[model samples]
Target: MVTYFEATLAQLSVHRVGNKGLNEFYSLSDNTLRIEDETLRRLLMQYFLSPFEKAYEVFRFTHSSDDLNLNELFHFSSMIFDDQSAFHNLSGQITKHLFNISNHPKIKSGELYIATFRDIQLEGELVDAIGIFKSETKESYLKVNPEEGGFALSYEEDAINITKLDKGCLIFNSEKEEGYKVIVIDQTNRTDAAYWKDEFLQLKIRNDSFNKTNITLGVCKDFITNKIDEDFEISKADKIDLLNKSMKYFKEKGSFNLDEFSEEVIGNPKAIESFKNFSREYNEEFDAGLDQPFDISGAAVKKQAKVFKSILKLDKNFHIYIHGNKDLIEKGFDEDKSMNFYKVYFKEEQ
Candidate 1:
């Protein structure tokens, strides 16, 4: 299991600065910038610089500049950056923000580069990226031969390697449900990019209320899809109808009422009894408190909308959507038939 750290940015400052030696690859003019925010800088050092080490993962923004009108300097995105203009702007912004973080303990006096590329191959995909790099050195002992005697150890500092990049943020221009998503790495000595890239960065981030909604919705989905199916001998059609009804209840209402939902969704007394047991098990299994009321997550419903469908593929000819009114569709068998026939009725065929 991965542990998530909480961070609070107190204040921030942004400024434009001249690029010292980053003009060759970036093609950026003196329009580069440096930001100075002590609280944010300390947070970055504590959370990221104090963690493991690895080269920063780059994500390109794929959205057009027209869709990237964002007023907030720090916006969250679900996707990665794949656009040149967007990635460049994002890199410039990151460099400026990182400039003001001078007094942090872990972040020594060093040069931070915002390198840009037209298209680079990452994870088998050719995309644009703005690489964030920091230049620092580690203390090392160099052996030197003295004219009078044997070799003596000389103290020297070696350039810090990119193998363990502990503190940096790769802000991609790609827009997600929130804003532009960034791959933030805070590795100290241990390098584990996969955990940060594949798992942590992929999580949905928003306000507390938004997160509560998604968590609640996710719990419901898991319970219906896994728990209910395991213990009960309910048909697929009934399950789908029940799921649709539950989703409808969540969407139409402001909050979730446990007892009311159990009565209305399941309807059967025995099933409600079974669901209570399932609810207990579900809470334990998923670490959720579904017995309490929570505001529904509209964003989560929109995101998980496709997964809630119940489809029937008939000989690859027609796909049926049995989302509601399970009684309207009858399941019948044909003699020596490999598949069951479904008699569907609709008020309007359209």
Candidate 2:
């Protein structure tokens, strides 16, 4: 949760980074941008910070060699954090580093903005943060104004939309030794080599309650939706019931215990054993460090609950939403009409 209602853009340095594989060049700004307009500063703040409001998973900068000094971005950002006077020079070095790594042809060349913020509210504390943003795409806007009793229209090309931030990251200055708490957004080049996050920032997901809860919910959904059907004869309603039960357990309990969840949600011994096997495979395949008997994150549950769909689609005609007891729903076949149907039992029609 990041809030910037009272934040001030202390310094900004803009630079142009081009694709290295295409033989393009990068240009650096000589000095920090002096933004005198309050309106523009507010809009810039909104553009850079709003996308992080829903970003729950935190990350920290990492290096393969396990040395922070080898990570150029981390070293440069540390320098900037240590001495504000070196911001512009360090931003130039950051731009050069990005240019060196932008060798992939698919990477777009855009203006890179290195900004420093003050008084940002993060988890109830007002901390200063460093922001790095790049604008890869632009939109065309038409402008119409009155010209001597007549309306004249003009168009501007290559305009950055303030609402859509292409790529950005906020580095809060709280955790210095552990590679300051970071949150990132990458709306462009997702399928490419992950140059923004992996190559440039070299970030690794922080191991915390949010990640644990998120990974556990993901594995549970995968097992219930995809894996269980292979071993057992289960109907759509039964699957929905299982999903509902899983959601109920997470919502009711403050922490997660693997054995307890399996016993409660998946009662059958065979099914519980199958679920454990699948969980192990999932954890190994994705390197999800799922800790047993860890606290569950309510925020993670709220975010993941959206994908636990309960809708059962039938042919082109009807859809059934199963949220409760599976016993109430009965599957039947009509020989006369040569069709199948579900007989739903309910107390009253809503």
Candidate 3:
């Protein structure tokens, strides 16, 4: 199974500082920027134009500007298009994916559990830096922040921020041999406790005992697709996007199936129609061995009456080829529920 396609490149981003003599560049709270090492902004700029970059820059500073939240940022960017879906379900392909930022935790119902260093005590040489946040809400998240001078991160008011809390903080320094301080009486559950245990383990695995970059953050995705439910996972893997296109040729001289030719993926409806009709007429005139145009009366005429023109569905990822031309996209499809043949029919201004 194919996985995620993440291309990480390290390049300098242009962040400005006032000419007052010292650097006064942007910050995430100021729009989530830094005076130096703003790699994410640079990457976004390369794909997007200057106006977009500036907008994002402004947004980062405003905090209210980002389109997606941290969990959403981590989720949508991680998946890609798949192949099996096209050959199988053949409809409603993931034309595109988007990331939406939100204030609430993406995992439905997990609040960040907060405890001050005073709340928890430390003793022996434990590995992961553990902070015991004692909040009424038993939710928690472990975020890695490099801009924080150290890898310490502190969440204030549900927003991610850099922290000065360090070894002095038990969460950042897992030197305690004893179990974590008991859960608050009001906040108690085996499931919640289990979640904390896993969080601590993942943290310890990441920063303390061993160094593993890939850590699991509890998340849930509402998988939306036109394909079968079983194939949802497969269609999201990173793979070569197979653009499918089919052309049927009909010539006058001989019934030509166009087995000798190939259709280019060039996006032009007229060019597409010209090819399909020319092939169809040519085949009718020649390949069918029809020496003359005659009236329809027999089984051949009845069969020919049902003959439908080819269809074309143009999209960002791949084109779809159904045997019959999509009169539906132009007519506006409000068809029955179970009907799954989805493709926008090219609408020409009549």
Error (Å) of candidate 3 at residue 223 is 46
Would you estimate the TM-scores of all the predictions? 0.44, 0.94, 0.14
Clashes (backbone N, CA, C under 3 Å), per candidate, total 24, 0, 32
Model 2 bad stretches (over 4 Å): 148-150, 284-287
| Model 3, span 1-350: residue lDDT tens | 00112222211112111111122222111121132545744443232222111110000000122322222211111121123222111110100111011111221222122111111112222222112221223224566678756676765355322121111112222212222212112124445343222222212121210011000000001111121133323221110011112212211212212222223321244434443454456446433322222222222222222322232433455554443333333322446753334445455855
- Please give the distance, in angstroms, between residue 127's alpha carbon in candidate 3 and its true position after superposition: 13
Winner on TM-score between 1 and 3 is 1
Error of 3 at 284 (Å): 79
Candidate 1 stretches with Cα past 4 Å from truth are 1-194, 197-207, 285-287, 336-338
* Candidate 1: residue 281 lDDT (0-100): 76
**Model 3: how far residue 123 lies from native, Å:** 3.9
Per-model lDDT: 0.51, 0.90, 0.23
Candidate 2 C-alpha lDDT tens digits along 214-330: 889988999999999999999888989999999999999999999999999999999999999988887787566773678989999999999999999998888899988889999
Per-residue error for 71 in candidate 1, Å, reads: 31
